[model samples]
Target chain A: MATTDKRDPRVVRTHNDVPAVALRLLLDEGWEAVTPVRVATEAGYSRATIYTHWPERIDLLRDAFAQFSEMPHHEASGDAELDLRGELASFSRAMVEHRLDRALATLAERTQTNPEIAPIRNTFVADGERPMRHTLRALAEDPAAEAALLMLTGMVTHSVLMHGTPPSDEVLDAAVDIVMRGLAQRD
Target chain B: MATTDKRDPRVVRTHNDVPAVALRLLLDEGWEAVTPVRVATEAGYSRATIYTHWPERIDLLRDAFAQFSEMPHHEASGDAELDLRGELASFSRAMVEHRLDRALATLAERTQTNPEIAPIRNTFVADGERPMRHTLRALAEDPAAEAALLMLTGMVTHSVLMHGTPPSDEVLDAAVDIVMRGLAQRD
Candidate 1:
């Protein structure tokens, strides 16, 4: 069964279960409130089993965030603005729905002081930015494309963190329109 | 003479000197090494005077960061790439020359936990990002502009914090060239 389980359904389920339980703990309480013991007990797993998979809470979290940043869940619409808006909406909704914003913020703040976590955090940023880069590159020349990507990411991050609400879908649509139209080749 | 003495140019110099001394102490040693009494003594100011202005050591540090972020010390060139390169260079040099990266990182982490300092930190980010937004707007027609900005900022920040050195001037120039060319309007 172990050999047949190359795509081991059980292992996949457990791996998936770990992050979900951890994320819920993070969102329901706060980052500070989560402990490996708590997570393992909550997930109905033994402490040793959880520890065997992730040596520490930080390792588990690093993996959880990596999973969170993975691009596939955010399906791309062929339309650039639509795609971008949908992706951002996914981020915003996740923040509000899970109440994960505070935990996420805590993770970000820790990146500055904790050398081990900083690279993991940077990796998350790089991965999240990839689709935006690809979309922007196709839309305009380098300088313009680069600026648009930064602006979009920065604006989205700032809006969510500062306002605790994503821009209205209408506002985001307008922003995408302005950005895309602005980047369109001028005579 | 007491009233005039308080208003003396020397007093102005003395008031301004406190933060400078604190900054030097922070960089020369480390943030943990800094104390309000030490800063006051180093600046040759009375503890009462330092307290009158800044109620806490963190308040003093936050004010220093605020002053530093706001100073119109570096001018941006009209050309987008040149302007960005200039800004990045100045920031990198400042971070590198004083060996302040660790201290600043520590302070940034403290700000997250310290409610009083968090707003000050946010203000600094908002202010620093304002010029970048203007630059992005001007270059909006180019899709690459936005991504270029993000990458460039990421590169500079990463280079300094991770690599612990300012990138060579040649490298900075080349990065600017690549981004500018990448965003150049399609003929």
Candidate 2:
């Protein structure tokens, strides 16, 4: 008889508790502070349990980032300009809400010296860039779309880092408007 | 009779050698690796000699960054669009040649967690931003100029970080063109 007991409480706890705790630590203390032992102590799990699931620290960091990267899907509405604005709005909002600028800046610093972490950081960037790229392609062709996407991201990052605050909605709108005008002129 | 040698060879060497070594360490090893002790060891100067010039680690980092930030003055060719293009080219070229992306990323990371370093970082950013803001204001008004400047920086940064190379001349030209058109449309 195949029996499903409400799943072992330990397994259930590890599954839910680990990532939640890891994310909280990451947000509260920055990436450097999110160590396995600290996460275990905070989450009330043994170190062995964390190690068993994620053998590498980067894996835990990646999991936290992955959770951070998850956002409502940005579907294009056929109006290229409107779509771009929507994407930019969402991006700015996410950056502020999640403190992604801080996380990204930390990872960017690490990637400069730590080759092992570069691919993981790159994956995080690429994943975040995917939807924007799609929306850009829907509006423009290859090279231009790619450049526009990069510029959009750069603008968002620059705003956050320079001001130490998430870009306001008005700023995001102005940026998208300018970029879109530029793209339209390109065509 | 008191005689002054043109400049003591050792004094000149310390002045020249310290920053050169610090910059090298920063580029090669990331910002964390560039410490007063490491600079002294690499430059063959006593820690006291290095400390005499830069009393604090942030001061040392700032001096290295200031040296890096020195660029040939970009003269506007009377044409606002052409001038913007020229500025973008210089910005892109400098970012690649000096590996400014890595340095800026590391500084950005530090600024988030270390309040002591934030002012120095802000000063660096402000200095870099001044010329672009001037060009932008020349093209448009206050708020638009501000937003355009931010987006321009963002695009350049994004290109370097994502591609691991400075943006090519073609890309810079295209970005400048798009931005110029957008500015024109704003008017």
Candidate 3:
């Protein structure tokens, strides 16, 4: 039977709990250890229950990743520069705090061979990029916006990969200032 | 007997041949398929022969990765702006052509728990970063230099991760120009 009933609190809790459990395993032990059986067992759900909900291991992973990939909502203040800086910092913090940079890199490597995971991986990229892209477009046009977006994201991702840690606040602020100054000078 | 003899042409040939063979398998089949047995069979060397050269599977993978991760050399043309631009383009081209981005991304993820691979991964990051860091230092100082390096690298890497390819020559040039201009305006 389908398990999509909103009225049943137990079903809703199980649905929410599965991905959380799977994500913890993924973070602790990498993707190979996140099998459906292991997730169900650790989550205190039955095999059939997890199967009914996710059906595929990739589906479970997609959900788990999506949970962490959520972007911060930015309400622009009167100062576009200040707003952009705040947004960039928030983005960097979220990525570091959730360990998305490492997770995304791991998944990006996998997407090269496993076609099934590419869409999930793309969603992760798209979701993360959307807010930055929006803010950049508001500040600059066409090629400049694209360049800024790449630079901002590149700085964050590169720092994480190189140091195995998210960049410090000072670094993030300095990066945003440099890029913002760069964009302003173009005008 | 030690396999490091200088006079033996055959040993030298086989010694050089194994990493190339393993790299090809890595590129064609992904990292999982690059086992010693498979590599020896493909390269027409015996397993014992390959083992003698590398001694461990991680050793073989390290050599294969090092082969791909070799960064390009960029000489200063006296114009710092032009030099930085050229360096950034060369870096992007090398990363794309060699598939170092994808390969390093894979290795970086493994380095977290695989202590055996951490040193190898560190070398890859350090080698890639040295030129960029050098160029940035020549252009700007301290936090700005660091930020520029991160942004430049991030742009190249983000393009690779999102598109499964390196940034195009046009995009790379435009990106360099934007960041260089940004740096120039800082002074």
Candidate 4:
């Protein structure tokens, strides 16, 4: 989240401001409500300026998600597996506490017909992947690491959201233990 | 799926007929469009009859889901582990082939404020669990079997729906293998 931009303060302000409005509208209404024109009108920016910044409809989501997609991260402990577990657990807690799980379900529903959102999902996945991918790679080989990442993140996302509650301690332990063991010795 | 019902044939037809129309509307136009009145109109039943059958708005979804909740099941193999894997994989494929993954994402979204849907989710879970839970119990202890079911199903659900594609064989193997190993020997 470092910023060493030499850009003017006004330019920086608008860059962040427009997407913030777009994201707020997305959360308040739904993804379908977050048009660039609507965001510009709401954010007090010129429609021409908004279009210039976001030439495509999906670009608005891209910008909005780019600003919002920094998932939880933790320091790398000596034990990669333990660090990975802690990060995953932290992400789980964050998703529940922020109610991002609902947002995820909404986006997922949209993904069925709108192929445009695929890249946004990929970005979200990559953002999530960064929080664990390095540590996972530390524990297993190439495909095994990717496989472990899928199981760990997918379990956390589905359980916390679909169950509509925070994960219980025992369930969390079972999920992490399985993936850890799976990573420790892949066939 | 057995019915030894002695109810009058006309009575039985209305019972099955209404929910099938509701489910069709749900899949075609989304859940919010499947109101009892709308369904009654579309299904050629009286509004009063729809009310008697559904009682509440959520009842429409409950009835629709009841008819649709039977997940893919497999004949039991002597090896519970193998049978469980086959069942899980089959369910994964069914969700993709039928595009129930999107339906799941939609239902999951509804579960947020609609506490009434919780039972529907549980019923869906139990229906899914039956296909593998008995064999999972044969392999693991009480909570472990439940935990294994959660991981196995959750991983498959999240990956297939969120990724918006069928799971590759490698990814499916990795997910099932991890949970299988996790269940085989829990510390």
Candidate 5:
């Protein structure tokens, strides 16, 4: 017999199933190709169920992004500056390598204008900023920590977002070196 | 004759008038509200004349952005690092203060997905990048100039675009201080 609980296991399973199936459809086709009715049919869920979980298309897309945003955080290995650089490079590479990056970026940009989506994006940015801040505090001397943190994230994020091609390893390496030099502590 | 040798003064006057009027409408009502008909009626020109001059909406928008982009480049004064900081703060302030920034950002993001507009956006970015690169080279030593250049623009643009609020003078000052310290030549 299926166990009955206030928060049912099946409901959790269903919630997980919806996004996984929706993402598969997104990856195979493109953003424009996916529609709520189609996603429901593909996911084997009723349209009402999909709506119950995610009221809007952007809501579903935001959930999909959450899947990747939880990617394993890069741990800083003792030396703070080096750890910061390596982590930034890794994060940049992860973002660029994902097939869904462009779709996600388009969504992120649209979120700025759409009232429903903006706060969700602000939360994501704040979450990203936190660990980097922690890493900088651990590694950088007090005066340099916050600035270095912003420059590192700004450079890496911009490089990934703006570059049409995945940056050559050499290019990313050069970018990291340049940022490091820029953030070098002063007297 | 007001002027009639090589270039007709009246034609020059008409050509300049189109963008100036278009820019006014854009700033007042937002870019979404702009239309060829609106521009023509407001500028006291015929719809056909506006069409003949621009041929496309993208062309009109691009020229408007370019006109603002070409405003007198500020010469950094005082210490090299201080001067660079001042120049960056001034640039960020100008961009954030401009009432049209939110509308321009909306258009820029739309271009990412709208195939017809993407190339126009890319061209604008490349055009903007050139002057920024030149400015950075003059401000900093060689190896890290490009990163310094990229970060300054990226941070300012993204901050305004994402936050939808002009950074306070103090915040801009903090950003400049941090970035300049990072880019300063080390002993």
Candidate 6:
């Protein structure tokens, strides 16, 4: 997977640029739209260049997914309440910015008839859920990590995607307050 | 539209049966597959009869949506906690039974490029959200109703659609507890 010249900035730009193009198409159009040829055209790379790096549609999708799934890391403030609120708010913003709801809903739709794509979505969700779960595990135990994260995801995603807007701070505060309150009661 | 013979059981069956056939197609194949011709062929009704009732694709989609959107009612037990938990658990079960997550995610995907289809989702969400709001409003007034509902929707949907299973009772209990705790803290 290494570029021919790792030290060359030009090669490095191609490494990132091609996948970003693929990711854009993947998000805007469904997976079928993302091909090595299309990525080369969009990214100003030769088809041979893209084919050399990504030989298959899945390779492009997986690489594009790596970009599609990027999240701005949240530095935990030691205040679980603030941390959770910040995480959910950032998620709402990201969904709107990336049209992530469309991406995810499309994934959900595809997984119905195409079972192989489930892993793509599972990987995407697991990457995001893994870290958040670590911070949230303190709220109760293992199961709470899952349930709480799903709740926050639903809250943020439903509002952003369904309503076509990010949730208001008022809703965010209440949601965060609810989770924290649930944890506090456990204590 | 009144059937020619409103009292005839065969006429009543045709009235409900045709739309149900359209609904099945809409849920399984997305909106484009549901048409008057498809419904007539599936329901064994004459194409002319179907056209008489549903002259356009929008007519078919709207009628199909009405059938697609039916939900079983949950009665309140005068215990808010029990009511909320029961509601969420049933939602998870219903989602599985109806493949509701696919239907909803498809609606979500369609709403992206088709502004006209937006009201279909809005009507669906509003239908589900309205009564839940009445019960959840007891927690922290207006805003909590919306936020809490979204969280619950997310929790159930992420589990059911993404993971291909419903939330476990343990997970459902924890989610309900968290929101209730948030409400108690506010009080």
- Which candidate leads in DockQ? 6
For model 1, the DockQ equals: 0.11
Stretches of candidate 5 above 4 Å error? A1-7, A20-38, A56-58, A99-108, A141-143, A160-184, B1-6, B21-35, B70-73, B99-104, B115-119, B126-132, B139-143, B163-187
Q: Fraction of true contacts kept, per model?
A: 0.04, 0.62, 0.65, 0.46, 0.20, 0.74
Q: For residue B128, give model 1's deviation from the true position in Å.
A: 2.9
Of all native A–B interface contacts, model 4 reproduces a fraction of 0.46
Chain B TM-score, one value per candidate, order as shown: 0.74, 0.84, 0.82, 0.86, 0.76, 0.86
**Candidate 3 residue spans exceeding 4 A from truth:** A1-7, A70-78, B1-7, B69-76, B168-170
In order, the Cα lDDT scores of the candidates are 0.61, 0.76, 0.76, 0.73, 0.61, 0.76
Error of 5 at B133 (Å): 2.9
User: Which 10 consecutive residues of model 2 chain B have the lowest summed lDDT?
Assistant: B1-10
What is the per-residue lDDT of model 4 for residues B14-92, given as tens digits with 9 covering 90 to 100? Answer: 9989988887788778878899889999999999999987899788888887766644467787776678668767877
Q: Is the docking of candidate 1 incorrect, acceptable, medium or high quality?
A: incorrect
Clashing pairs in 5: A182-B182
Instruction: Return model 1's CA RMSD, one decimal.
Output: 6.5
Which is better, 2 or 4, measured by lDDT? 2
lDDT value for model 5: 0.61
Better candidate number, 5 or 6, judged by DockQ = 6
Q: How large is the interface RMSD of each prediction?
A: 7.6, 1.7, 1.7, 2.2, 3.7, 1.6
lDDT score of model 1? 0.61
lDDT minimum window of 10 residues, candidate 6 chain B = B1-10
Model 4 alpha-carbon drift over 4 Å, by segment = A1-4, A41-48, A185-187, B1-3, B142-144
Ranked by DockQ, the better of candidates 2 and 5 is 2
Model 1 lDDT per residue over A42-130, tens place:
99999988898889888777766666663343577778777777766765576566543554455554554466777666666667677
What is candidate 2's lDDT per residue for B1-187, written digit by digit as tens? 1156577777766766787788888889877778999998988888998889889888788778777666664787778777777777777777767777777887788888788877777887888777778878888875667767877777777666644566666666676777788878975
Where does candidate 3 chain B have its weakest 10-residue lDDT segment?
B68-77
- Order of all candidates by DockQ, from best down to worst? 6, 3, 2, 4, 5, 1
Instruction: At residue B91, give the lDDT of candidate 6.
Output: 77
**Tens digit of per-residue lDDT, candidate 4, span A17-135:** 98888877877777778897799899999999898888997888888777656544667786876786687778777776655676677677767657778778766767766768788
